[model samples]
Target: MKLYNDTNAFGLVSRANHWISAFLFIGLIALGIYMHELPKSPEKFELYDLHKSLGIGLFVLMMLRLVWLKISPNPEQISHNRFEHILAHSVKGILYLAMIMMPISGWIMSNSGGHEVAFFNLFTLPNLVGENETVHEIAEGIHGTMGPLMILVIALHIAGALKHHLIYKDNTLKRMLGKK
Candidate 1:
């Protein structure tokens, strides 16, 4: 199987990482929204637990992706214009920033709320921040707000990729999709 990305396409591993992270991010958002809407009940608790679990999972995947990105070179730029290049890089940078920060903020919020964060009913994550009502409230607000922003960013990213694929007929989407 392909191990490293080429100029025209991403490798198998990168594609897998990208898609897995995408699915997990979407799942976490859905669970979080549902949890927020639910009344104070055991079902809400369960949804929160699932949200925490998925957040931790996404964090792990993001860390792995960082390592992979550093070690394995990615496809070269498809745009020659400096403006386009900057825009492309900025979009990716924001996505990476959100992916890294969102889960960290969630963990801190949970810890501040004195909630136990578990990973798929496997192991419990240690609290990063001490319990405090104010901290919990602030962190929860930030964490909750960041989720929708991330969704927007991801949507823009996908739109740009599709534009490259269907309109510009460039290799941007193909590179990410592992196509040649």
Candidate 2:
């Protein structure tokens, strides 16, 4: 496969970014949900640290994806229907926003809650803001709400992709898969 995107199909970098981010994103969601119910313990703390580290990794990956997109533009939408194209674009926009918002909000929540966000225990990210209850609560609220909404949007995206491949019999999925 080509290493950069072209008008006809996604290239190696884009596909790699998409699949890796998908895996990490889904893993983060599962990890977050599983950890939520855990009682206070050393294991819970370690899990939280892992979650934070993974989240930071995701944030970095997304930012890199954005840069890669700028460097190598994406293929055109396979759908000719205006509504379908618009809807797909909208869902993708929300996904991108969520990808960015989730991690930053989590970091803000952590920092404002007086917790250091260590990236895989190698180093701690600098706090976005000084410790403040209001900031903490606001970040927490955003993180909580965005998490579910992100899941919904992700589901919609997957469904749309399936619709394109299974029903429309188009190259929407194949293009991303680097298939002709």
Strongest candidate by TM-score: 2
lDDT of 1 by residue, 1-180 (tens): 787776667888788989899899888887888789899999888888888887888889899888988888677778757886788889888878888888988888988988878898889988788899999999888888988887888887887787788888977776677666
Give the per-residue Cα lDDT of candidate 2 at 43. Answer: 94
Q: Model 2 clash pairs? A: none
Clashing pairs in 1: none
Compared with the true structure, what per-residue lDDT tens digits does model 2 show for residues 21-86?
898888888888888889999999899999999999999999999999899988887876899899
Q: After superposition, how far is residue 179 of candidate 1 from its true place, in Å?
A: 2.2
Q: lDDT for model 2, please.
A: 0.90
- Name the Cα RMSD for model 1: 1.5
TM-score of each: 0.92, 0.96
lDDT of 1 at 40: 100
lDDT of 1: 0.83
